[model samples]
Target: MPKGVVRKALEGFQPYVPGEQPPDGEGWIKLNTNESPLPPSPKVIAAIKEAATDALRLYPSPTAAPAREAIARKFQLDPTRVTVGNGGDELIELCFRAFAGAGDTVAFPTPTYPLFEPLCRLHEAAPSRHPTEAFAELPPSLGPDPSPLKFIVNPNSPTGALFEARDVEAAVAASSGVVAIDEAYVDFAPRSAVDLLNTHDNVLLLRTFSKSYGLAGMRIGFALGSPDLIEALDAVKDSYNVDRLAIVAAAVAIGDDQHHRKVVDEVVKNRTELADALERRGFEVVPSAANFVFVRPPKPAAEVVAALRERKVLVRHYDREPIAGWIRVTVGTREQHEKLLGALKEIL
Candidate 1:
């Protein structure tokens, strides 16, 4: 607790704040975090249970080979091009270790992923933020930022706005550093930047089982890129960064392609319905490619958020510039959306 005991770089660091996780079965309609509106594939659950054996006493594959192989097969990429992580969030941190460093600049568009700014501070790296306007466009300066590492959150958070594949490729092509395209929500979107991998070795795509796969609690994610990039991620990753059960869960989840498609289909269908419902209520809903809708409510976002909390309805709100007065609401089932809409009607 001593003032000087902590690292100098973390002297006054503020950590990333996640969404409210109220106790389950409390009658609260949770819509803050972009969790899957459904449970994970039954196969993933069964596999995890089967893997919970005396073998747990042994350490998991340091490289998470099974998961890497499964992910590679799913994406039709070579196994060497895959690297599994605790979550897509961990992969973002590892990019800092593998590419960016102290005093190095980490570039990304402003107000993309809030985690990036805090991670930059945690790693003692400088943040090179470029601004985006109207529909969450990629920052114009991003392509020229000579930072050692850069990030692009496709189907970008909060705004949920997706960029053109050509535009994203242009940025990656122009960049002089490692470009990480965070596709954590791509399964809900129309296109992916995976093709950029064939043309550019410096581009890495981060995917997660949390959103579309409904495995947030399992904490499984993977990266796809050139073999060299994956090797660097492996080098910087913690030993057994992903646990045995999680690896099994990932493998089974990836194998159950039918379930994966069902999950995406449901979320995408519900996302469209939810966005339309919000717009009808006079909320200026941003065009979302992800499983959430970002909108400016007709009233003060802070007030609306607080009122909803009083009614046990949770949604994320922003008070900062640019996105101030906007709220991000995760797409839940139709029943949950009804509850949320009812609460908004009462509050308004």
Candidate 2:
């Protein structure tokens, strides 16, 4: 391990920072990561248990056909147009590998997903950032000439701001290269860009079982696009990316629409209640379309975060400009929300 052996491209690379996960048995109210508060469908649990048998002695299907087919059936897409992955994060990296090359630029809006830039750096691709207050509008600079590989996180993370389907369609129509819409939180939004799939071949819609399906621990996600883009992703991804248990769980979860809808409804209800409560406390709460809300308290964000931690309630705080003063809170169950609000009341 010599210092000079490191790649020059990674000279100043900064890794993505995920939300903090406190240790188990810490008696902490976890509301940092945007995981569903509800558990997965009983059918999903049964499927996972059934899959955890002697069958694991064999390799999983490299193509992940069953899970892909289940996702396609859910979205009314062809099996050839779906690609499953270990998680949405892996799918993002696959997009970078399949489409971007050295010196090519990968573009995404700032204050969106934190992983996009790091993935671009990992691929030795130049990173281009478009600054936006909220993700309600597309960057005017995105078009055919520069032709960068673009990633858009609908109902964006941290901010929880959502862009309309028409805005996404406009971006796809104008882009020369690929346009990937990370719909990881679209289950809680009013509409999805999947409706534009038939008309746009350049758009890739990414979904995860982690959010609404309550399969975050399973680490299963999928992407939908034209057959060509899906083929490219399949070719670049690691073989046997989705394990047997994860595949079975995701398939069952996707097929259980009633369970998924009920969880999403509950999250949406809690989100509204939490936002209203925050606003009533003299905090400026941004309207959220996802399962989290971004709020700017009267005090500095770092101090507020520390205070919350002291009270054994955890939320997320970023150290970036324009958003450093804001904290992102995931909407948990009603009891969790009550605990969070009570903590905030004391802190404020």
Candidate 3:
């Protein structure tokens, strides 16, 4: 195929690049991606192993019915109000498919999930970017923009700062378009925006099993919203967006509340220690409510990350303005923290 064969919308497209995922068993301390240091619940593992049988020849449930029901029970919502996806990323894209279109406007705060901007290009949707000062609050102009779709990444990524629930609700209440509140990191945050669904019909709260559930490899997630919104997503989604194994993992993961709490509690505890260590080392640590800490190192951000990488330590580095000179390190186990701290001490 010729280069010109590509769509005009993505003539020179730049896709979203995830954090460094070096090959496994390579001795790298992977604190770049926010994965739970602990393994998934034993129950989820048992369920996956149990479901992986002759059923492999058959397609999984198209609607991911069992997982939807499980999520509904946890959230105390009707099954019609829930929808499962391959991951939270898929649910985000579904919102674009169901609402925004070519030449349409899609609004979101900046320094959020990098995938949003790339999706805008792929969909030919004009991006209405509202810049935030240090990941503080929802942009005021976002609500009044009247874009067909808007996204608020609560406990926004990279920076790991959780926005106030009232501020998020205010944005949803004021917006004339569909508002997708991405709570992928909400499990580690102090509050959630799920309550907004009751007061506003246009709000959708997206979640994932990848983080707290320790199922990143499973790649499963879900959304909670009015039946109308869920129905729209179901309409645009693939015949079987959530696969058999992933669906099984999601169902059991949501049902194991004890294991879920353990994951969150561990991350929260590790988060405080990681933040304090960074600050004591002269890094300006931003207040974090997510599973990661964002900080401006005393040394150049790029240099620090490169040095750490040389030591088989991985942490995310940012170079764009407003967040330039900043690094985001996921909260890991105490042993991993000591390794990271040692590596940083040598580097700094």
Give the least accurate 10-residue stretch of model 3, judged by summed lDDT. Answer: 1-10
Q: Per-residue lDDT tens digits of candidate 3, residues 1-348?
A: 236988766788988889888888988899998988999999999999999999889999999999999999999999999999988999999999999989999999988888999999989998999988658677787778889899999899878888877788778888988999999999999889878888999999999998999999999999999999999999999998989999989989999999999999999999999999999999998899899999999999999999999999999898988788999999999999999999998988
Could you tell me how far off, in angstroms, the CA of residue 65 lies in candidate 1 after the best superposition? 1.2
User: Mind giving the per-residue lDDT tens digits that candidate 1 earns over 110-220?
Assistant: 788899988998899999988887666787778988998999999899789998887899999999889999999999899999888999999999999999999999998
Looking at model 2, report the run of 10 residues with the lowest lDDT sum: 139-148
Clash number for each model: 0, 0, 0
User: How many clashes does the backbone of model 2 have?
Assistant: 0
Report how far off residue 45 is in candidate 2 (Å): 0.8
1 versus 2: better TM-score goes to: 1
Quality of model 2 by C-alpha lDDT: 0.88
